[model samples]
Target chain A: MTAKITVEPSQKRQQAKQLREQQLLILAQQILQQDGFAGLTMDRLTALSSVSKGTIYNHFCSKEDLFTALSVDSLQRQLQLFQRALQIPGHSREQVLALHLAYHRFSMTEPTLFLCLLTATTPAVVEKSSPARLALRQQLELQLAAICQQLITAAIAEGSLQLAAGQSVDALAFVQWAQAFGANALLKPTQQLGLFSQLQPQPTMLLGVNLLLDGLNWKPLSSDWDYHASWQRIMTILATEAPGADGQLN
Target chain B: MTAKITVEPSQKRQQAKQLREQQLLILAQQILQQDGFAGLTMDRLTALSSVSKGTIYNHFCSKEDLFTALSVDSLQRQLQLFQRALQIPGHSREQVLALHLAYHRFSMTEPTLFLCLLTATTPAVVEKSSPARLALRQQLELQLAAICQQLITAAIAEGSLQLAAGQSVDALAFVQWAQAFGANALLKPTQQLGLFSQLQPQPTMLLGVNLLLDGLNWKPLSSDWDYHASWQRIMTILATEAPGADGQLN
Candidate 1:
């Protein structure tokens, strides 16, 4: 009876610790959204969480580590979204577009969180991040890449896509990922810099993908079909809040 | 004679101002290279440049403005490199790959400078920069985009490339820019994340561009011609330090 009672206290303590860590992350995210990276300081987190500096340090080794943890959380959410996107019924190319749409929606909804992930890529952040956290980030990325590989394999098997002489599915998948990442990351800055006006993220992204697929000679070519219409359909199937022709999220 | 003397002093003053600004920028770049963004502060600039805070402020409104100015300098260099890349004689598509190769070289040679440009896109930096600096940055970007546009237009006119239905050259150019930017930006992080062991920046980038061009059905398809040979030729023509087959920069 005494052993059972002691075990119950330890389990309760573990649950409370988990609850506090989650609450800290939620507050950190709020702070990031309200103010940019410059606003996220350890003192502010300590004040906001009402947790002592010692306890906070126990949860996260440092401020960069905390941000790394947040980035891991963001990546987890992305993994979840990517998995859900796979279930959206469509052709393999459209399915790939759906994955792009998923990332786009996530970026739009959580711009600050997206920025946090980008910031984590900096050498300063990577250098300071805990090994365990970095490993977790890598594992999550591999999972995301696997989902993309499945889509690419499907496209090739269905004869809608063909690999070039030296191109592997992995290479193509990385290219698709890099293209999407670049478009989304540069969208705001390029707009602010007055480079590409009337830049529709969803359409532009789909257009880039379509052109790449067309380059790959993926069939039902843009010349033979309306990929723009397919883009809107993927957006709907994915239930994305992607801005429409009017640039209003539906 | 009195009027001539007064004019001479003014001209001398203008020349001196320009010299001082250039010196400050060089010092700032050194500081950035030696230390990351966090190491860049007004005090450090003053200490390094031996210029008073007031003079530094006259040159740059704030620390963010200093970074913006650095970003502008980086963009100007990119513009110069892109123009030089254009002089590399090749087919229009090869010329575009040459442009990509030039950017890849710049990223590899001056990763820190490349990062300063990326940091400039952050909201905190953007929000704090002066209007004039922002305008200069935009104008530089437009010039860069125009260079890419020139290449794309030549590709289409030569019957080497075609625009899909309803696709503008501007859209295609932007897509190309995004692909290059995405591939370069993600190259370091993806490798650091250990996601792809064999991810070579040059080949992966060339492959992505090849796939994109192939998707466009740009003539002299990868199946018909060995673009890898062309990539090496571009390196030779542009005199790039692009890694050899052994992946060592020449």
Candidate 2:
């Protein structure tokens, strides 16, 4: 019996580990969907996943670690979907409009996951999670920056629009991205029951994106930059100067 | 002790009640600012407030009640400050611009509070504290509606813009307000870093608001009505038909 038990060990551990990961992930989703964040517990996860108690500890050290893994996977899928929404400029504005649609679609499709990531994103949660949390934020921002860069650069080259001096086009992306977050977080539920269905984020997206474009537009003084370019001039100075802000340029 | 208490009891109950309420309110804020939502305990409220356990219960039946009153006060103050940002839009464009700045300013100043009221506006919390939470969201929408209404109303009156035959000015307000919520909540963090100082929402506000204005510009051939709008429209409709989706809209 002792010899047979020893023989059952090595390969079973690897196979069990793989199965455990899949089960934990499924358990994590069920916990999120059924109980919300506050309701999650290690005992619950083990029971729901039908995995052994010691096996879980061998895999994940804590509930937060397990949830974090689940969250990262969820975010990756979201970013992949979001990438499709970001059309290069030659594409019709309908394609541009689709980007905003993509955001809401993600939020609706993954409300529980969305809640986990975004709700966990509060400074309160982030401070403790530290490097992981910060990295997640930067990751999302980078994707946003890439999409925005493509759109603005294409728009400028296509001559459909122009950007002003010193605007990263990346910064504007951050703004639009943030606005999209807000729309998902605040807009839909605030509306008078189905109002978001009647209206979409096109206008909001256009307003934010177009405004950044208007400022960056070396289009012409005749267009009446109405925005008072002093702000733009400041940004341009900061970007190109490369100053340490301690008066040294790096 | 009983005989001594009986001598002053009934006559001082009203005064005692007010004092206990004040103490409870202070304790609730202490819990919020220090411990956050999770750490707020009834025993903690009683201890921190320096009021007796029974006294706190006498004024606020539960810890949640104390939180409700505290939230109402904070939210009301926030809206008051935010609305001041929307006062008297100097131009059709200014109306939208002012709204964005006002929103951004308020959010940056009071992010955690905004997160509490706007993001954390869930039903479990709202079912008990209906008036305060519901009023805040509705009030926000009303203000946003007013801004869009003012812009469209001004443009229509001046002949600078037209409304599609069946469209109402309120249509623009709905989208504008929703976007405002989005932009304010998401963008403030980066904007505060001054990384987005140049993108200054003014232009985005103008462009997006203008796009909606233009989209709804009464182009006779426009057939894009009578369809499901997008995203939160479903929630908005559900909210309307039931009026019980969540606590606050924004």
* Highest-scoring model, DockQ: 1
Q: What is the lDDT of residue A233 in candidate 1?
A: 78
Each candidate's chain B TM-score? 0.89, 0.56
Off by over 4 Å in 1: A1-14, A157-159, A240-250, B1-11, B35-42, B240-250
For B34-144, candidate 1 gives per-residue lDDT tens digits of: 887657778988987777999889988888898888889888878877877888777787788888988987888888878878778776678788999999999999999
lDDT of each: 0.81, 0.52
TM-score of chain A of each: 0.87, 0.62
**lDDT of candidate 1 over A105-207, digit per residue (tens):** 7788778778777777766566677888889889999989888888888888989988766678888889889888888888877886678886667778888
lDDT of 1: 0.81
